[model samples]
Target: MTARTFQATNPATGQPLSPAFPVTTPQELASIVAAASEAARGFAASAPQLRADFLNAAAAGIEARAGELIAAAMGETGLPEARLRGEVGRTANQLRLFARVAAEGSWVDARIDHGDPSRKPLPKPDVRSLRVPLGPVAVFGASNFPLAFSVAGGDTASALAAGCPVVVKAHPAHPATSRLAAEAIQEAAAQVGLPAGVFGIIYEDGYELGVQLAQHPDIHAVGFTGSRTGGLALVAAAQARDVPIPVYAEMSSVNPSVFTQAALEAKAAALADGLAVSISGSGGQLCTQPGLLFVPVGQVGDEFLQQVAARLDATPACTLLTGGILKAYQQGAAGHLAKAGIQALTQGAATQIGAQPQLLGVPLAQFTAELADEVFGPISVAVRYEDLTEVTPVLAGLEGQLTATLHATDDELDGLSDLLHAMGTRAGRVVLNGFPTGVEVGHAMVHGGPFPATSDGGSSTSVGSRAIERFTRLRAYQDFPDRALPPELQDANPHGLWRLMDGERTR
Candidate 1:
């Protein structure tokens, strides 16, 4: 059976973009999954050097097509040229970083304990362990971050770096951008002489495709970034499979920011300005956007909110990613306004399809459980707390988040040691004094969190070199001969890696 085709649309002008993407038929999807499943063995067996080369080639391919990728992404996403260009650079850099990770080889976490037949009553057996690939992965391209989190995004890079094949399900909102990015990956794989199925891209707008992809026997793992409903759907599909797979879904967060009396007083103007950009930047589509902010009631009181309101009043209107996003934002904001204790501090002025930044406020007692919910567009709620005692409970009441922030002063830290601990416990990352919008891609970066923030179970990130670990699992070898042992575990140290030998660290 022939599947329908989906055309991309320009979010900026709501016009159709060229190069319609075809949805895969069940037969075709089966073929693609079969190819990837067949290719997974060879990909997992391929030398780390070869995989590194492929990643480097992929980086080069993306760099070579920077202009075209950025242009298409800008047109489809309605993001500024500068932002699109930066995203392309980030994507290319991320690929290179993973390439370095592949070449360095420490990502395998190889450890060897040599046979110690001497001391004890019983001799210890030689034991060696290292991580290995989990086979093919199904990566869901996110709509908001077309370049950085889509087709050739971190999920694919990490999966491939871990020696797993990847099949990308392109986001409908930016199908054109996804197609171009996927082409770069394909070309790079071909250049590196990797199997054609080592990387695959499928374009589909419906949930059926996603459900099938998740349920496919060949797909060993899943990676996704989107709304809670979408993420949960994938999770449900994967769980219902005969052999359930891990689905790393970065779903939703109300990344809450709490203000200290000192920090707010000192950085009030600056915080207002920075939060304004963070909340609305990229049409307020960022997963890390501060959705809820907390302020002390008695000390800062109405003055702090008024100051923030004035600054936001100056913030110019910007277009949201899509009409649906705008509508959701409007509905969410309207709901906040109608709630019992919440008041519309600053209502939006936008008549177009753009986001008119809005701020809602409620006293500590009246701040309901619903206030913690994230409004996807350029809107946030300010919760006023009476005392530090009330602060922790309110913060603890919110669900899991990607980030929780504290704008505490040096003097405040003494009083806030417990509060800071509480904030860090609830969030994946705790921001000390700055905004939570900008998430850096690094080894220590924890982009994933508990529950609704992510499906990773607070153990991994979709961003960083550590992300490669998610695509792999540990394999142990016991009592293996020197000649037959893998290079990473052999005494000759062919790979020259650091490992624990009989409890002593060695190279």
Candidate 2:
């Protein structure tokens, strides 16, 4: 089959960044999946350490070309060079983290329940359990996170580490960057002598191919990061398949931050500036960006409003990712401004394709009635309440979010522990005194939440080694012969890694 290409255009300059490519056909997608599935059978058989080496090499390649990738990403996505560079670092760091996780091997949760050899009753049968790949995984790229959630981003990295061949449906927003990253991974695979089909990229212009990819029979699971509507649509399609598969779809959210009276009193000005930067960071395209601010009533709230207004005015209007996004931001902002009793506290001068940060303030009741929802841009809604008692009810009214932050003094936190717990239940991450824009790739980071935030609330592949769990499945080698066991889980302990024996953790 012949390969087709698509053109990438710079959103900021209205110039063609790369030639357009033809969409991957259903027949081609099937062929790609067949090869990937075959490769996954062998890749999964390889030692975990070998897989880790390849992943680490991929990280090195990404770091080596960080500058070139960042420049291309910035041009294509209309993001600043600094932000793109930071994202590149984050992308490479995530790869390295996953590599280490794969090397450790315990993430597979290998458990061996040896027969009670000396039991008074009949000896129990040996039972062992281990995680195995869920076969070929289909990942849908995200527009905002061209690197960290793109072609070689968390989903792809985690799937590959889990021994699942990955086929990424590239986001059209940054095709050139995606192609470049995909090339790096292909090189890493070859250097490690991994199968060529272990990683594949499909460039498509619309959702039709993505839908087909998710519904394909050979595709065992899917990883998606995008809008709520898009994610849910994929979920529906997956469910409709004859043999339904799991879809780990992380949707959108309006991460809310609550400021207690004491914190607002202590550092209103600094907090205001910090929020301005967070809201406007990457033009507020991040899923973790704090879109709603809850402020206490009285002098502190008034002071915060003043500081926030100043910051918003001072921040410049930079170009957004695309004209569609800019138009959406304008429309969403205008919709809120048009709502009854909603007042614009501060409005920044609009730019041709980008918008300056805008601050809107309204009465607690009125704002909650009108603008408490997400607008998906560099726009923040400040809602003031009479006291702490009014905060919980408002937070409770919110949809599930990726993050919820609290700016509070120690005393305030102590008093609001219950409230914080309640808020924690509603959000994936409950942060204190910090904005939610920077998501750390650590064991404790939970980057998914309920409903609109993410389709799966019980388990989120957000941070740490657990991210690979989404692309893997548990397989029990019940009462099977030794020859049937995979090498990684053999009795000889070829990998020299930790495993569970008789329900106890062991090395």
Candidate 3:
């Protein structure tokens, strides 16, 4: 039987791009998994330097063909050239950052408890531990971040850095972009003399292929970024496996942005303008886009909202990444306004193809939990609160989030300890006087949160250096000969890693 093929569509024009990609058959999926399982042994055993070199080479390959990548991505994603270019750069830099961490050889966190031969009439056995790869991984490409979180994105980079072979299910939204990135990684793998299965990508437009990949016995872990439903599906598949594996799925977040009374008095216009940009940027497709805005209930708040409405009114409609997304946005916005007490503050001129940004408002007394649900486009809900304390309950009632932002003066913040603590409890990252759309990729960044924000119990991140730990598992060797220990844990410290020796940290 012939397998079905899918083609990328130019979201802006509703035109299909050239070169359709075939969906992976069950046979092909099995073969890919088998090869990756075989490659896992050699790949995981290779020295960290080899992995680092491969990552660097992949970054270089992507850079060499940046123009081609950016062009293809623009057509498929409807994103501006500047934003796509930046995404490409961020992707490359992310790979390089993981490469540096991989080569450093200390992120594995080697720890050794030296044997005590004569301690209180009892001998303490030596125990050494370090993180090891969890074998092959399955990565699901995300639609919003076609480059940075797709084929060779953070998941693949961190998995490969941890010495785990990766099989990525290319996002159908941007298959061409996925192919280009996959080619770079494949070239890098060949140049580094790694096995063919060290990195691979398959294309499909449905959920079955992704679930199959997650359920594969040889795939020991999964990385995903998408809707709550999609992430949970992968989680369910992994859990149903005979040997369940971890699924580090970053799912959903309605990143809440709050404005204190003082902040409104100080810079209402600036705050309104920034929030408009944050909500409408990239059609509000970002996972961290502020979905809810909290403002004080007063004349000042009404004035600020009016200013925000004007800015949003003047803002032109944006072409979303997909036609389906646009439809959903329209429907979502209409449904939101249909509810009692929920009124549309500003809804830009409607377009046949693009999404018109919208700002809706409802008093705290009528703010239902359903209203807080993410609309997934250029839309935000304005919740009017009588006092800062009045909104604390609302915050507590909400689900986990990627970020919670506060706009307030220094003096206002001094009295916001309890509010700040509440925000901290509900979100992974808290922002002060800044929007959450611009997520920085750094060691200190926490891109995952509790529950529906992520599926890994919020203990892991999908970005930064610590992301590598998601594909790793700690192994402790007790009472083993020095030669039997891994290099990082050997008595001689051959890897020159900083180890937690006995009760102190040392090299």
Candidate 4:
């Protein structure tokens, strides 16, 4: 039988884009996995500088084709030109950042302990340890981020930086964009003299191909960024494998933000405006959009809600990334509105072109278990609380979040310390007097959180320099000749990398 094929569609017009991509068959998947496995041996043995060079070349390639990439992404994702342009730049910068980490050669956390022969009683054997690549990795491109978290995004960059071959399952929403980005990486590999299987991309409409990729024995790890159901599915598949591999899946987060009485009194207007933009930006498709907002119940809080409603009333509707996402957003938002005591603060006129921005209000007393769920669109819930203590139970009931933000003054902080601490414990990153929609890519950024926020329960991150750690495993060599030791762990420090030598950090 012939393999199935699919095409991309312009979300704005609901018209299909050309170049139908063939579905990756089981035979094709097997061939790809076999090649990746063979390539992993040489790729893992390659010097950090070589891999770094490849990453740098890939970044340059993406930059060279920025216009084409951004145009393709804009049509498929229904995102504005400025947003898609920024995403393309972020994607290239991510590659260069990982390249820097790879070239530095110190991220492996090398450790060495010299043997002691004439000590009190027994001789201590020399031991050295460093991180090693976990072979080939399976990456699932995200529907939300067509570039920065997709085909040549952070996952692929960090995996390659850690010396692993990568096979990416292109997100069905933007296959053409994925193809462009994948081609850039392939060209970069060729220019750097890397093997053909060092980077690969395949297209499929549903979850079956991705599940097979996760279960493939040769795939030593998985990187995913999507819904909780999808992430859990890959985790289960990886666990069911004959030899289980790690799945670093960043799933869901409501990203609740709390406002203090003082904050509302001081700058309720500014806060309301900024938050409206954050919630409605990117059609509310961002993973870090503040899905929930808690505010003090009073005249100030009531007025603040009115201001937010006014801003949201003027906010325009936007086309979602895909038709399925649009349907899901409508259903989720409708479910929230149907609950008792959930009043629509401000709602845009519904349109066939896209989703409308919505703001719903409810008292903390009427909060329900269903309210904690993420609506995943241009929608946010504002809960009124008489005291911070009243929100404690609600906080406790929430799943782990990617971020928890506090809008407060210095005086109010002392009184809310316990509440702040609670937020910190439940979230991967805590923000003070700020919103969580825009995520900064850096060494200190933690994009993963506990339980449903990420499959690993905050043990790993899908962004930043440390993201390379997800594709690596620790290995130690004992009583071996210096020649046999990896350069990072060598006594002479051939790579000139920082190491924990004899329990002391040194070069």
Candidate 5:
């Protein structure tokens, strides 16, 4: 059956600029998921080197067409050229990094135990266990990050690296960019000799297709990045399944910031500069932007707010991702102003598809109630506190956050133990004297947190090499002959990977 098509529009100029995209119906989408399910089996049995080769080639395909990717993303998203280019580079590097992770062969977390016939207790049977891919994954494209969090993004990269086939739901806002990325993946799959259904991309403009894809019987897991409401909807859909599957949704987070008295006294201006940039950059579309700034009340707090206000006023209005995002930002700005205690430190006008920077000041006494909602544009609310004791309650009111930041001083360091402890309970990543915008994709970056920030913290992370584990589960093979055991679990350790053997860590 032929699917109806839609045209992609340029956010900045409100003009159509697509090569045209076909929005898949539920039945068509279900068939794609089933194909991925079948492809996952063959891909999982393929050698790790083979999978790694496909990932590397996919990166090459994106890099080869970097110009088109960047231009298409720039048109769909209002982001500048440099930022778009950087995201393109990040998307390619992420794919290459996963390729390296696939080649490492140690992520399986292999373990082995030989039969103990000599022990006084009954002889134990031999046990060998290693992680294996869960199955086909359904990844939802993100509106903010077309390439990095969309087709061939971290979710797709990690799932493919785990040897699972992927069925991605392309974001409607950037169909041209999504199509470009999908082409790269398909080309790489064919070049690397991957099966026909190794990768599939389904496009849709509404919630029906996403829900169908999530509830599809063949899908073993789901990956998503978006608003709290959207992520929660996907979570609910996945749970309603008879055999529920895990959904790793990187959702909402109003990442908070703290400034101690001592730090505020010395580096007030510097901290203000950093906070202003982090809050307003990319029109506050980044999940890690410091949305709440807590300042110690007094002359220091007053001066800090003034400095940040100056920066905010100077920030020029930028084109947002879409009309919907602009409307939400306007509603948030209007809501903050209507509040009894909320004060607008800096204000900007809203256009049909544009938003200016907004900075509001919320008093400490009323901050907990007034600033609980997230403002998803170039905005940040500064909260001023009279007593140090009041700080804890405000932090307590926050829902789970992706990051909590503090720009502190040496004198205040000793007394921050309690604040650090409190921040640890609520945030996934804590930054000392720094902004939370630039998340490094490395071994230790935790880009998720408790509910609202992320759907699942125990099972996975949305960024870094550790994300590969989200698509795999452990299986134990007992009483198998040496040759029958998986190569990684064998006594010889042919993979040269670190493993837990006979109750000891060995290679």
Candidate 6:
């Protein structure tokens, strides 16, 4: 009967940061989706360059308001100003990158096959295919990447670029930032002459509205970035629909890193510092954070653990993203410590909320069972192994991960090639001698994995140009005349881009 507003609270101070706006009810969500569906029809008919202009304008808007957005993100998320600023840069860069890719017009994978007049018995038919918008898309905001994975983030940008209207479900953790970003998108849409309903944000406190949106008949696809439980719930909801739609849900992972003997022997202390920063950076809130680490046994391994423990002791406990996240992190850390074979190698004294980082460690065997799970906060488990022989089995036991890192020297890489291959099979992306925290938004990055890592491995990342594929569908224009061909697939080559011709790659 009445609309309820969702409040945004400062994680650090436990104070109300801003007044809330009216939450979208199921009926409102339906109306929004309907409007988006209608807008998507007309938007899809517009030229690709026009869509590019909107994305470019959106990027400029985001950059102009970077200060306000970053401050609001920090105030609500308890993240440092520098981190928020960097995230804002990532968000804007992602939008611009998609804009460029969309403007290039090659991602559609347009193809044409000219009719063969001299066929054996029958004349060949002209065949053409191109990617089209799947229609209205429902995006679930991620708590971790408040800016880059939220309202004006990659999911929304790529979908819009692909000609799909986006209806975002705001994450409860950073409602203020979500609303601000939504306003930016709305302004950008208006400036670019796009329909107002092309982008909508539903600020619902409960998850039911999101469920309804996912199952809505008009919504052609769903893009999500969140926990396993939540992502799976959306997948189930989508499946229950009369005609199931694809749901691209990136869930949780314990992104594991391996340290070969040769590399550790060469730079044990340096690796220690790098791992500490990677594990503790952003309070270990990043999905790509190295949660499980496998180290080779011997003096080198012992030294690595000792250095890690010392660093853990020195580091202080920082406030998590929210009170709920903090509580969960504390419980997870305590549970691992209480396991039989596990020992708290080092435990930092808890600091005031939003003060400093928290660090903890456990033995290899116990951590294998107890700490393999993601705690989603500032914590990591050092799982030491006797040799490379034991690494595969340990990694094999891990759930799906967004990334797996191998710190190996040139000589060690040859011997560990099998292990790396196996890790690659299990993870969405494999890294060598690198931390996974700084995920580059490029063509090479694969930010999804199996099972709990993501619901659909085909569409995981919200960064880079690959993201546009999620919001598009392929359509074959059989026996179509040359005059009726889409602009990207016309014989005249209006876009002047590469395309596949009769199974052959060509321009």
lDDT of each: 0.84, 0.83, 0.90, 0.90, 0.86, 0.82
* Model 2 lDDT tens row, 206-246: 78889999998989999998877898999999999999999
| TM-score of candidate 4 versus the correct structure, residues matched by position | 0.98
| lDDT score at residue 416, model 3, on the 0-100 scale | 87
In Å, residue 114's CA in model 5 sits off its true spot by 1.7
Give me candidate 6's TM-score against the actual structure. Answer: 0.96
* RMSD to true structure for each model, in Å: 1.7, 2.0, 1.2, 1.2, 1.5, 1.9
Error of 6 at 41 (Å): 1.2
The digit string of per-residue lDDT tens for model 1 on 23-138 reads: 87778788888889999999998888889899888888888888888888887778888888888889988998899888788887778776778848999888899999999999
TM-score list, all predictions: 0.96, 0.95, 0.98, 0.98, 0.97, 0.96
- Which residue pairs of candidate 5 clash? none
Clashing pairs in 1: none
- The positional error of residue 250 in candidate 4, measured at the CA in angstroms, is 1.0
Q: What local lDDT does model 6 show for residue 378?
A: 67
Q: Which ten residues in a row have the lowest lDDT in candidate 5?
A: 364-373
Candidates 1 and 5, the one with greater TM-score? 5
Weakest 10 consecutive residues, lDDT, candidate 1? 347-356
Higher-TM-score candidate of 2 and 3: 3
